[model samples]
Target: MLIKNYRTQFTEELTSIFDEKEIESFFYIILEAFHELKRVDLVLNPNLELDTIQLLQWETVLSQLKEQKPIQYILGETEFFGLPFYVNENTLIPRPETEELVEWIIEDLKIKKFKDLKILDIGTGSGCIAITLAKNLPNASVFAIDVSEKALVTAKKNAELNEVKVTFIEKNILETEDLNQQFDIIVSNPPYVRNLEKQEIHKNVLEYEPHLALFVEDNDALLFYRKITELATKNLSKNGQLYFEINQYLGKEMVELLEKYNFENIELKKDIYGNDRMIRCVLKS
Candidate 1:
């Protein structure tokens, strides 16, 4: 019942499945979210105890974690680009690599002081990218689209929660012929993982994350990228930029793909882990 006792029990129970530090970290996260109690609270009040309902909450989370469910999904929320987002089985949890992509766009456009720019986020998932951009770049009009209406519902809630206005559309990119509306920037962190690469995924992700938002056929790994590029060819404004959070193994292939599509100033960037994880290209002015 005591906070310290629960912390130790939590780590011991999850030690076989997760690292001690990770379990401790997740414990602190849940602790704060559920009880508004921080690590310092446990230290200052060593006798602090969890009530019956709170103990049950911890038990439920532990059970889900043992099944390799993601903590974000267990909590039904996550933070992206320093903003909170609601997430569920329908959406892919936004990742740090995608935050880097958003930062790159923000840094470029903030310096340019672009006015009334239009930004589109294909496969928006939790609306993290669109809402973050709208929050950061007040001058930009943000729009996001996903094939799943369920994902869009969560994305819209996230936008409202963050107090930023982003137009959310439920449309499958593969079935669409054109974007119709031209945009100064278009970004997508689509389903880039090849089916063969499932071996490389973490159990928590491969088992719990949305497969529709993560994977593509091994024989056609670039299916979403190709379709988005085709749409960009028709819909990107003159001087518009295109960005993608790409699969690390496909950097060279992505470069060739963009070249074929006539996207200039193509730049492939590495994430914090030093893997080629993002690419940006601009239309010829």
Candidate 2:
């Protein structure tokens, strides 16, 4: 069948669930992934056709999109920090804001010219943070910790996929007392979403994403931050930095929490959307 005709059918089936532009984008994404065709290809060769097997592949993705499944998960892969990553239900899809967090770290460290720093990434779901850092800072040693074994498996695969060496450990951060070793930088984008914020989440996320990686109790939304900060105090080297992708609504509270731990140079940063989304501080010498 003609690819253009299939696109019309795909758009009609998902129009109620997604906007026209989104549906079109999904069509092109799937076209490239499954058929090696791009939007320009469709324009240049309007008579492009899909074989029987390719049509089945497109149909499956179309049905999944109609159910509001995220396109990344439907493809079982995603790009983060300009690197390819394998993603599944076991791991949370890396977000653009988290990429911003990674960029902030890279920019700061690049200025410092730390030739050989040790970095630890807590709750490293898909090893996005740790692997990206290792890939960019070739001289740095990177370690990642995740509580879920399945998540660690995916993270390990991502580390290999990105051709970065990251030591991944499976341990619950909230239950640990000590890191046993100091790190030059400690970072995390942990579960910070409050239960009260569930209503604000879209159906695709609420229904398809991993809740274990996305949420914390409403009454204790800062649980991960508090615990990670406490660990950073003991585990970070003197003058080392601690960074967090935080709950946007709790920036002030985050500063207070970090200040209480005697960290210095605390900074709360806003994402592109102007939400207070990340924080960084220094361990006092």
Candidate 3:
């Protein structure tokens, strides 16, 4: 069948499940992933045909998409901070808000002129934040930890895929007593979504993404943050800074949480949507 014909049918079928813009994006993203075809290629070659094998592949993806599966997981890869990452059920697909957290850290490093700094990423799903930081901040020693062995495996694979050296460790942040070594920076985009908030999450996310990485108990919404903060007090070097990509609705509580630990320069910054989504704290020497 001609590619354009399949594209038209694909859009019409998915319009009910997803909006027009998202359906269009899924169409082209699949084309690029499966056939090295871009939007321009489709425009230039309007009559391009899809062979039987290719059609079968796309049919499978279409079935999954109809079931509310996320396109990122269906594709088994995603882009973050302009770098490619491998993702799956084992890892949460990197979110744009988390990308913003990475940017804040990178910008801070550029301003400080810091080098050879030791950095740790807590619960580093897919190793997106840790790997990106390692790639961008060449002089920084990056390490990542996660409780899920399956997730760590994916994260390790991502580190190698991105050609960044990050030490991947399998450890539960909540159960850990301490990080034996000091780090110039410690950052976590940990589980901050409360169980009650699941209704607020998209069906694609709630159904396809790993809940271990996405959720927290409503009674203890800051459990991971509190644990990481405690660990940072012992693990953070003099004048070290900590960063968090927090739950948007809990910004005020996050401020109070950091202040309880005496984290100085506690700044709550909004993401592109102006939701309070990122926080930075420093411990002075």
> Whole-model Cα lDDT per candidate?
0.92, 0.92, 0.92
- Please identify which of the two predictions, 1 or 3, would achieve the higher TM-score against the true structure: 3
Clashes of 3: 0
lDDT of 3 by residue, 126-185 (tens): 999999999999889999999999999989898889898999999988889988999999
- Cα error of candidate 2 at position 203, Å: 0.8
Per-candidate clashes, comma-separated: 0, 0, 0
Candidate 2 lDDT tens digits, 1-285:
998888788888898899888887888888788867788888999998889988988888888887889999999998998999999999999999999999999999988755469999999998899999999889999999999999999999998898889999999999999999999999999999999999999999999999999999988989999999999989998779999999999999999999999999999999999999999999888
Candidate 1 — which residues are off by over 4 angstroms?
none
lDDT of 1 by residue, 1-285 (tens): 887898888888899999878888899889888988899988899998889998999999999988889999999998998889999999998899999999999998976655579999999999999999999988789999999899999999998899989999999999999989899999999999998889999998998888999999999998999999999999998888999999999999999999999999999999999999999998766
lDDT of 1 at 255: 94
In candidate 3, which residue pairs get closer than 3 Å at backbone N, Cα or C atoms, i.e. clash? Answer: none
lDDT of 3: 0.92
